[model samples]
Target: MRIGLIGAGRIGQVHARSLAADPRVGELAVTDLSPAHASAVAGQVGGRALPTVAELLDSAPDAVVVAAPTDTHAELIIQCCARDVPVFCEKPCVTDQDAAQRLVDQVAASGVPVQVGFQRRFDPGYRRGHQDARSGVLGELRRVHLVTADPAPPPAAYVTVSGGIHRDCQIHDFDVLRWVTGREVVEVFATGANRGADHIGAAGDVDEAAALLTLDDGSIVTMQASRYNGAGYDVRMELAGTEATIAVGLDSQVPLRSVEPAPLGHPERVWSSFLDRFAAAYRAEMAAFLTMVERSDPSPCTVDDARRALLIAEAVAASRRARRPVPVGEPSSSPVGLGSS
Candidate 1:
């Protein structure tokens, strides 16, 4: 399987390395607006760099992974599908629900596989939680609380172009909620504030945000996302039900202090290498995508999954914007195009 990569940013580079590492993949090709950036990554993976999207398509790679910036996803995806090149797009399929639906419809009609990069679903911890939820261990689920925070805010430029806090950051939690519960979010009520940093406010984002989401089955999920945290990245959830409650978090990491002096000091758990976790998931997701491309197998993250995740994110953003509860529904009958970046 030959893989071509679009964009040479941090995630693009990660995917490039992961794809190359897969024994199933033969050669890797990469492209970025900045040719130098593309070449640098290509050098690391023993892959050539393409100058344009068309060139990459003309190369006839078995599949293309679109890891470009969020704003450019829709068009590049459409183009890849047009070439009958399967795509593996990163999260937030599109910043807006309407555009995302259109893209989804197009892909569905094409009968080609396009997997969204919600790699968290493949994480072993999350997978265990999902199984427990599905196996009735959480018995008649009542509530799910998700807390996700980045170590620090993104660059001002990225925060500006990113759809917003909900779309840019919290959307992962929204997707995780749906995947774990196996239920659709029917409505959302969200609240946000710009208390963390003045720069975040200037970047058109809230430093802290929370949402109360209701699933169609009367399941309630509480999601909290923060762009600033004093420590390393933290993503955890506690699912409570009538029978029992299960919680998963980044419990242990490096930078530990040991004291065997009978309650003299406490050990500090710090994860110095969080990327290792993500790398495992990335490899799993890529392998799944390759299998789909080879045998036309069902994708791990289908278009419907992407659409639903985006819907929940949009609902949360709308709820925050209007300061009222918002119901999830189909994008307006009037289909729309891309939003201004």
Candidate 2:
């Protein structure tokens, strides 16, 4: 299969290597705003670099991977759909709610399978949790707790347009929460504090946040995110149910310590970033996309799935500002100003 990749940035580079290494991928073409960057990645991956998106698409690749900036996702996905090319796009298909809805409708009308990248859905631990929860092995999930913290904050300029922590960081938790539990978030109450970085506060964003989410089945979920987790990058989820309790990201490398007398030993090495933590999952998702293209299967993670997760993030952001619970899908009293990471 021939694959076209847009963008040559960090995530795009990751996808380039993944796609290039795949035995099924006979050809890989990449494009970016920086021709040099595209050429570098293409050289490293044994692929070819194209000068523009038009040329890459015109090359008639079997499928396209939209690993470009978040703001460019909808346009690129629509372009791929117009050519009946299956697309695997990175998350938050569109940050703006109305635009997301329109993109969802457009993609649906195009009859092209579009898979949104929420790589956690491909992680082994999260996949196990999803299977257990849906197969009744977890038995009546009672509560869920999720934590996603970065080792450090992004640049202040990024914060200014990041759509705040809820959309930028914790949206992963939101997407995985729904995927693992097969539940819809009905309401959200969120709060935040600017404890670590003055610039984050200055930009009207928080360095830390927490949210309480109510699921459609009355299960309660608590999520926390921080940009100042000095220890390491930490992402974990615990599901407590009537029959059993399960935890993900509880491996030997987890960046956590117990103060008890008989405590577990310190981690030998901690994950430094999302890329390190989810490398395998990223590869797995890309492989899944290729399989979908090969078999003509429907998208496992559809655009509408991404839209639902974005709605939850918007509700969380609105609740943080309003200091009250916000119903999912409710029109925000004020603009949520959805932005991407």
Over 110-165, each residue of candidate 1 has an lDDT whose tens digit, in order, gives 88789999988888788989999999998899999998777677777777777677
For 69-143, candidate 2 gives per-residue lDDT tens digits of 777889999999999999999886787688888998999999999999999999999999999899998889999
lDDT of 2 at 63: 97
Give the CA lDDT, 0 to 100, for residue 87 in model 1.
90
Worst 10 residues of 1 by lDDT: 332-341
Per-residue error for 47 in candidate 1, Å, reads 1.0
Where does the lowest 10-residue lDDT sum fall in candidate 2? 332-341
lDDT of 1 at 49: 93
TM-score (C-alpha, index-matched) for candidate 2? 0.97
The residue pairs in collision within model 2 are none
